[model samples]
Target: MRSIKPTHLRRRAFPRYLSTTTSAQPHIVPITSLLIANRGEIALRIHKTAERLGIKTTTLYTDPDASSQHASCSPHSVGLGAADGYLDGERIVKLAKQHGIQALHPGYGFLSENSAFAKRCEQEGVVFIGPPAQAMADMGDKARSKEIMTEAGVPCVPGYHGGEQGEAELLEHAKLIQFPVLLKSVRGGGGKGMRIVMEEGEFLQQLKSARAEARASFGEGGEVMLVEKYIVRPRHVEVQVFADKHGNCVALGERDCSVQRRHQKILEESPAPDLDNVTRLELWEKARTAALAVGYVGAGTVEFIFDKDTGDFYFMEMNTRLQVEHPVSEMVTGTDLVEWQFRVAAGERLPLTQKEIIERIQERGAAIEARIYAENPERGFLPDSGKLVHLRTPRVSEDIRIDAGFVEGDTVTEAYDGMIAKLIVRGQDRETAIRRMELALRDYEVVGLSTNIEFLKRLCRSPAFIAGDVETGFIEKWKEELFDPVVVNPEVFVQAALGVFTSHITKDAEPHGESLGFGTNSSERRFLFKSLDVLDPKGGEEVEVSITQKGNNLFDARILRKDEKAQVFENLVSSSAFAAGKTGLTTFFPHTRIETTVIEDPNNDNKLTVFQTGAKTELSLISPAWYERALGLKELRASVAAPMPCKILKNEVKEGDRVTKGAPLVVIESMKMETVIRSPQDGVIKKLAHKEGDKCKAGTILVVFEEEEGAATAR
Candidate 1:
């Protein structure tokens, strides 16, 4: 592949259609003008399809995302800062009216599942490019969707998808479903308002919490939880099915979304690995049936969870809009689902039959997609937000596709999803696809923020994944092996350490001097670093050394010794430092006391600070903007503060009321999760900043406390 800069790939501006063509062979109705109501990679993907179909596209973004790639995808773009516009239905409608936008496509999240939004679009004379409002309303609700599926002869996970949400009712239902039930919100997706109860003892507490979250997020309170059976050793797979206005529906294919975390899809692939022909065809038929049963139109996904052992699959949930991983299905199927969504919206019939769709998948190849997010894998996968300094992706081939909405120098904020881009690869087969993905990952690089790139690489090469023995618990099962770089392959560690060391040394070889020109000045030289470290076996701290020079493809560094000794490793650049060790790699980085593992490769004339006083200095570097403030504020406080941008649910205490530490103060909800604001200190409530439904943020004080007259301050 030729090395072409991203600028060279810039598409020519599209012109508005002068006229429409009519043919006898089910001529596809071309969408004239479209407005994308979401931001990020998915929006970018939809833009590409709209561009290819000669459809005029309009993209919207927030203030922080004004310069986002999605904004640049089309010629006509608008900046709708969340505070200024975007979510404001009236502003969006006004913009559409001004631009003469014929259709509105809610790409996946945000307003996609909002039935009222869809209805409003219909009322304002703009086509909603998704399932019908009635269909969305039915499927968007967990309980209603389950009832529909059950009536249609589709196997549903046993659950209580009915009545008002309550702790008493949900707990009773959970007891019937047995231990390890999933308490889900009836109104939302993306794992929000969802919680897993591992045992009966935690049912009531978790149920109450889940309901509070659902109420806060969806604006409808009560016990509207779906008490369902939690399937173990489950594989998350969904079928992409599309229907037209003429009552014809077809299933494109299936996508394996088994790789997940906290019940959210992270990695996805087409033609799920290890499935037999019978099972494969069965899934597709089931999807087709589900779509036809609901009289579904536009693009929709029928999700299901399969039991690897029994091969029993149960309906999970139906996403009423386009999915984030729809690109994978598109790559393998050789069809643009988004354009079809528009065609159907325009009252067109499906262009192809089920047989034709099946033949199409065979003509192309298998595809896999891995989502790259701005998160720290070592720190509980906490979201990392910061300005991206250097971003680069290798050449894109027929087999390689990248979907992104951010560029280098763009700041990732905490107010939105942490996704940066998607690394998608296609191959003649699964093995080839896996290998191509590995190469693509290595060639792809992003600097200035923490990400899960390394973690994904480890996952791509894992034995279970390679052998097609993956399930929903894949990440959890391989948590220790996937992360914890200290136990990395000796060869990989050696190579990475060498590469980083040599790059730095090569850059600073001239007069900046090795170690800031502090040559052999042991007294004046103090060094500190935060490389993935290894604990010392002989009561000494173990460390992974940062290499400074790449001599003949080998790392040249000094490995610290027990008696302050140094050793060298030469030519072995790919060796890993994380080998077998006593303790497992800890998830918390702050508490981890790992030392850098280094070895002397070249005889150094300059003094290097690999070890300091028989210990390694801690290096904690990450996007500080995304770090949770609550995790940082461990000091004394009379009352708890809001965790994020949210509204007050209900205050439990009144002014002048006495409360003990850890007692519930005010319930603040954000993104649907009801986080009970608790008192950090024992004192009498002096003031209440918020009432039953007040909007607040992380620093927004909920309540104030006064110390007892005779008691000293807790501090």
Candidate 2:
């Protein structure tokens, strides 16, 4: 990997299409070369669109990412050090100058929302392919943005957006609106810097915390505004709107981003399910009006919170840049938003009108997108770090599109966002699109790192999800039912065990030897069995696992005790020999061989090697399996543990506390969200794990209880 600077790889700006036969005015500038100031899928997405328009693309990469898919795609790519400040305006300006880059595209994150950065680009004689800094500044202010939305006839959520209001005033407003109001920062858009207070007593406390978080997340935490009406089952629906310098604005369509965790969307799809035609028209019309009112240009999203109970919606906020889930909108609209951004910046009129866009949506409709992230949902959805040992993505046809950042062996660090790829699938109808996406996800496998692929599969097939009854609380409500991994079908366990065993023998057996053991009339064969303890990350409870294997393709396992012990739940295993001969069977047992298929090399993010002969003790392979089995333990224990390491904010239990099963015992704070640890069984508190200020991790033993004399103890 040579060290190439952004200047050397800068794409030249293409002149506008010469004298279009149409009467539409010429674009502002012929966008020739564009420097994408971000990395990964977004950078690649921008590069592809820019290239298609005859525009050259400039991309920068950290040393480790020099060989990324996006980097290789660009005609010219520069390698920059991660510590060299890719997000810094000075560094970007320097690159632009060196590359002779005419414009800068701040993909989606990092410097995308930085008004000063955009202003710097303007001052440095570089075009920032986004909205004017002033527009971003105005909309960036929560109070001012709300004022604009309210003035424009968009139903803004009622609450305090006023500049200054005391805690008492906010409390009074809360009281008037009733409890369960949303305490939000004026500049808050994402789930961050926001809190949902269910009671009046928690108002001031939550307000302070929200303000502190806001100040940390966005400089100058503005007045803490209150939105009186908070929808419990709210759907996040946003309209993608694009405007040009000529004042021509159009709304592409709506995307249902209701599938979210901690206020951040995970899975997003276009053509919101069950959205009434009347509401759809109204939403598009309102989105167009909002964009026009703000003088917004380029690609932006007008977000709204839709309530299923009342069929009413309120404008949430306007994202003044490309959204993370724009692919879904693009698939349905048949419009390339990135290309439009270039043309709009080039001073071209919006290629389509609002009416025309509506007609087009009616014709070409239905698409869905799922964000594939290198995250572990079973572990409180924490970000994961590792290399892409073996990356295999499904091929994209007309209906499937995959936008990824890294390639095989690429490292996914915690320093950046968890997203690895965007899986977008399109169909004439929603069912076809979803089914196609499921197939793609199954085929798409990344072995080395932990991801939410399994979770996404479950979400897509969820009855509630299929019915479009999705809300922000969907994950919470159905998590228990959706995440019971303990009860895997007997056949899967048998296959997995055999795979493991076969892998072990292949590695240890002599090159010419027929069998290590388990041959004709063979018994008492000596084999090392490394027992793994699989514990839940959130709760430190461990499940008992029993694995027994005979020959290559035969195995059986049992759960000694489930966390939530029910009637003796049992499992059986079955397998068929693959080699089909005595010599082959003795040499390489099919089950053990397949069970131990090395999807990835645990250490090298780049290399994926399987166990062949010299069997060595490795923890990585078995540990994840252990954890996955722990994850399978669906039933909650009679005891409660901390979901994550967090300070015990408040305790609802005391020594000798008589509580029923499911009773809330303590409220633990982690990453700002307060999760209440509930009692799994009706029992008296025999012991307390921590005090109010004591911190504990997920699986931390928080409390214990003494069982009845005749009751069987957890074995």
Candidate 3:
């Protein structure tokens, strides 16, 4: 890829459509070129709309994402070194000016809600395609937003949003609000900087952790914290509103974002299911009132925590920018919200009135969107970071939309959000939409790094979710079932073995020599037994697979257990009839067909990684002798290792420190979440491997503990 210098791209003359019109028509500021001030899927989303409007798009990327899919979509892109560069308002403004950008679109996250960044864009004479600076400042702070909502006649949760900033005062406020309160950073919006204190005994510790996280995430603004009464069994619902400079504002119904993990939304659907008409109308009315109260412009979301059983709702906070789940709203309303933001920023009146928007919502039906993240659900949903070797989404149709940030071969690094894509589908009703989403998730395949694809599928198919009985605590309530270990059927193991065996024979075959111990003579190639150890994400199992070659590219396979005699339980399979690609393989059996991707494990020549139906399994083709040797190897260890790549935030224990079982030895931060490493047993710390500020990879020992004398004997 050739690097294009910024100097070579100069400002060109504006087209007639973007030029100022002098007729009696409504005066509008023409924007011919836009600078996308964010990265990933949202940036690409904005560029698509900009291109449709005949606006040239320019994007800024971090060094790691310089060649990312979003970067490739834009005709002009500038490489910003790292996170700091992307958040540098002055640097971004300078680049926008140099590139002759007419407007700057902060595509959510990062500087999207930063009032200072918006002000900087305004100062640079570049249209900021969002709300005015004052609106952001008013609603950007959670505590302040609650006050504004209350003043605007919108119901707000009962809590302390006062100016007091002391820890004691906050604790006292929590006591007044009763136990089981929430300590949240006034400046925080995602799940970051938020903690739930369940009792008096845990208040102080929770407060300290929350404050530290707040300071790390929000900096100076994080110094102030707010205490709120925790709503039990609460449903997270937010209303999407759009406004224009012409004093017209319309609420585009509501979306239920209650399906969450760690307070971050994973699934969202528009026109909240099973909602009463009265409550729905009230939500929209209050949302409209709030938008008008702030003189809001462009797209924004007003979030509320609704008590499902009581039919009561309270204002939580307002996002003064486009949201991650805006696609659900777009799917149901048939509106391109990005285009709406651009037109509104250009001083155009809303294309539709409030009544018209509501009517459109009723006509368009239901839509649901499931966020596809590059994280492991079984491993405490720890975010995974690495290259995406192979990526595939469900077939795109009018009802199915795949908004992805990364592509095949792109890397999902630890420096950014783990969201790889969003699967959005529309249907005539909620049930239809739910079924469509489940099918799409099954079809989505991502190889190399772990993802929440399987978990999402289970969640979608869960009885509670399908029945629309969901809340913010849905995941917690069904944790056991959602994270249950996947049981790979014996058939799946046999299929994977055959896939690798066939691939190896085809690629490494000699004209007339023996292959896979199979003699060239047809009569002698009756049955070949291959003892294999198969490893899925959960665990590994050993089994003997026998195959009989019937003809060229044809074979019959079966699993042989040590205790039982080998028997063929399935019909023969012809490999030549199946579709096999470099990265993907399709196998056909008697009653079922399985599609999978096969990749040779680089570290082990005999091992192959197979991806089927969103699950990854590793197959190790080894002889019985090797399998016996592997089983005899001891795997016990005395060191506490990092579960994932992260920075060592703090070492709670030093060398020679005595610790009991489950004692936290160190704290590490990964993908914005902090995890503490705990001792596996009572022991003495023999060594400390890493220190604060050190970066460590998965399995890097952080602390080495020596078992107490006779500890193993005692166990």
TM-score per candidate, chains pooled: 0.73, 0.73, 0.89
Q: Write the per-residue lDDT of candidate 3 for residues 588-688, one digit (tens) a residue.
A: 67687777666654434555566676565555655445454446443344677777789998999989889898898888888777777777678888889
Stretches of candidate 1 off by over 4 Å are: 1-29, 83-85, 215-217, 221-223, 487-528, 532-565, 569-715
Each model's C-alpha lDDT?
0.67, 0.67, 0.77
lDDT of 2 by residue, 95-163 (tens): 998899999999987678777888889899898999988888777776787788888888876666664
The alpha-carbon deviation from the true structure for residue 433 of candidate 3, after best TM-score superposition, in angstroms, is: 0.6
Error of 3 at 48 (Å): 0.3
Q: Write the per-residue lDDT of candidate 1 for residues 1-715, one digit (tens) a residue.
A: 0111222233433212111232433444456899999887878888888888888899998887777788788888988866335567678877898889988888888788888889889999888899888998888877888778778777777777778455676678778888788888778677777888899987887777776666645665434678887877889989998887766777888999999875667889998998766666666666776776776788999998787766678888899998888889988888778878878888887777777777788877789999998876654555566677556665788889888878876877656767898888888888899989877786655655567776787788898898888899898898777754433222333332343343334444422112434454321111222233223222213333434434333334444423555554543333323221111111111233223333221222121212211221222211122122213333334444554556788888989888887788887654334557677667898889888888764456777777454332221
- How many clashes does each candidate structure show, in the order listed? 43, 35, 0
TM-score of candidate 2 relative to the true fold = 0.73
- The prediction achieving the highest TM-score against the true structure is 3
